[model samples]
Target: MPLRKADVVDEALRFIDSEGLDQLTMRKLGAALNVQGGALYRHFPNKEALLDAMADKIVEGIGDPLPDTAWFDQVRILGNRLRTALLSRRDGARVMAGTFSPGANTVIGTDKAVQVLSRAGLPPAQAGWVSFALFYYVLGHAIEEQAQLGLPPDHDWRERTGRLAVEVSPQYAAALDSLSGTDPAERFDYGLNVFVEGLRRLQEKERAAQEHAAR
Candidate 1:
């Protein structure tokens, strides 16, 4: 049977989940899906094209912004949701990290993120810059988090903490110890709040400077 685009993307996602991104290739993917190598060529001209398709679909899973969601709500929800999706699969963040695709989902996701920032009163350039920064940070963190999710021994963090405990303040060590078993969701919320808060502060400072200069 001939494979459809959805089938191709689904197979690609599953292959990434099982084998990790480094090992994913058109030849290998074809074998995984029980199809000939050329089967992929019919849908995607080359390995690069195949990757583009996979990246597009992955970004596509980021749903449209809810009408009821405010700027903070929309941006927060989108950021966290995307991070989760990418981390859910093996090397998923790595696959989507530098992918440049013009697919529907990729474009729409960018539009929604930018729109949320614009609604908050930012001009086109600032909104675009910060929105991209937020998304990049989430992707970068998710990749690191997923990579460390399965440590053979949890003692690595302990050893590092011990080093910091010796040189850093006791309060720092205490804070680190306090989060030995911290909830991932809580950590995500805290970090996201920091990012958005920083953005708000920047906007406020810019507005204040403008007002002072006008006087």
Candidate 2:
């Protein structure tokens, strides 16, 4: 059977799921696909290109944005969906960290979110910046979640954190202790809510300022 680019990328993702991002190489991926390493080059050109394709595939789970949604809901939905997709594969976040496709799918998804914000009255540039910030927040949180997966479930980090917090200042230790045992999902939602709320206030402020200038 002849090899196709999609076939190579799909097999590569399965290889990473079993072996992890660190273990992925064209030579190894080709071996998994029952072909020579050189065969992958015809499809990917290099390992970086393959990783970029994998990153794009990870975001495909977001699908197209729904039509006529509130700007805040669009941001929240996309952010949550991106995190879920990254969590679906082993070391998926690490694989996607610096890779972006810049193709039709990625561009359309991103532009749609930014357009939502723009329609909410933010300047186009600010809307774009907010969209990028949401992307970064999702990527950073996913990476942290995946990295923590390697630690023993029962291992206690509280003592270590407490000691470091005390060294910073008494007030810092007290604040850190207050947040102990907070659910990860709750923390994610808390930060996300803060971001969207902050954006709302910012848009309101901008509108007020523009009105003042016009009056």
Candidate 3:
């Protein structure tokens, strides 16, 4: 079979999954694809372009948002879907952390999010800004989650924190203890809810001000 652009991306993702993102190189991907390193440059000008494609592939896998849901639910669903996609492959979050793809899937997903917010009564500018804010929150959370996953199996954050907390003030220890039993998913949901609730309040306030001004 002949090599294609999609072929290169698929193999690159596979390479990242098995060997981690830091280990992926054009030469290695080319070797795996059984072609010369120069061959990939035909599809992607450089490794950064390949990473962007891989990030787009991750977004592409998120499919579509649910139908007829409340804007808040829709936002939550998008955040969860993004997180799930990022966690699907090893170092997946790391692969997407700083890369932005103007790829179709990425643009479509972003547009949908902005549309949802705009429909919920936010101005287009605010909606777009909120969309990017939500994206960064999810990406940042996923990056931290993936980094933790990379740690040794027995690594216990609380246990480690407890040891250091004792040396710090009691208030610091108490604050750290607040995170005691919650898993990453729970923490993610809590943060997402907080963000959505804030957006809801802002929308309501804006609507109220608009109504007042019209009187």
Candidate 4:
């Protein structure tokens, strides 16, 4: 069977998963596919194009937000889905951060988010900004999460942090200790909840201002 663009992308992702993103190259991907490096250019003009495709693939896995859900819930669902997708592949967040594909899946997901926010009563501009804000929040967190994955299994993050805090700023050690037991998922949910609640409040304030203007 002949190799397709999708096949190339799949192999690239697999290579990334096994060897890490930094080790991926056109030559290696072609070798994995048993073709010359130039053969890849038939599907992707350059390494950048290939990376964009990989990032789109990650976004495609996120699927669509659930129907008939509240806007806040929809936002939460999308945020969680994106985080999971990024974490699924090794260095997935780095791939996503490096490329701006504007591919179909990216466009569809973004449009759906903007539509949800718009329906929640935000103006188009604000809705767009909020969509980007939600995306950045997820991306930033996923990047940090993936970075943490590189740590040694026996790493005691709290202990190290506490020691550093005590050495540099004893007064802030108590605050640092608060992070002792919480896991990444718990922290992610807490941040997401706080963000959504702030958005809810903003929507209410917008509504109240409109009502006042009408009066």
Residue 119 deviation, candidate 1, in Å? 1.5
- C-alpha lDDT of candidate 4 relative to the true structure: 0.88
Candidate 1 per-residue lDDT, tens place, 1-215, comes to: 66897898899989888877888888998998899988888899887777777877777767664658567778888888788777677877877775776578777887878888898879989889987888888887777677666555554555786775567777776676655467666777788889988877887898899899999
- List all candidate RMSDs to the true structure: 3.1, 2.4, 2.3, 2.3
User: Model 1, which residues run further than 4 Å from truth?
Assistant: 160-180, 208-215
List the pairs of residues colliding in candidate 2. Answer: none
Model 2, span 1-215: residue lDDT tens:
89999898899889888988898888888889899999989988788898888888877847574656777887788778878888888888998886755555567667877877888887789889888998889888888878877767664555777566545667765655544456666777888999998988887898899999999
Backbone steric clashes in candidate 1, count: 0
Native-referenced Cα lDDT, model 1: 0.78
Please, what is the TM-score per model? 0.82, 0.88, 0.90, 0.91
Give a tens-digit lDDT track for model 4, residues 1-215. Answer: 88899999999999999999999999999999999999999999999999999999988946574769798998888889889998999999999999966788888888888888999998899999999999999999999888878977777655786575546466465554544446889989999999999999989998999999999
Clashes of each: 0, 0, 0, 0
* Tens digits of lDDT, candidate 3, 60-83: 845485779798889999888889
Query: In model 2, which regions exceed 4 Å deviation?
Result: 61-63, 161-180
Q: Which consecutive 10 residues in model 1 have the weakest lDDT in total?
A: 149-158
Error of 3 at 137 (Å): 0.5
CA shift of 112, model 2, Å = 1.7
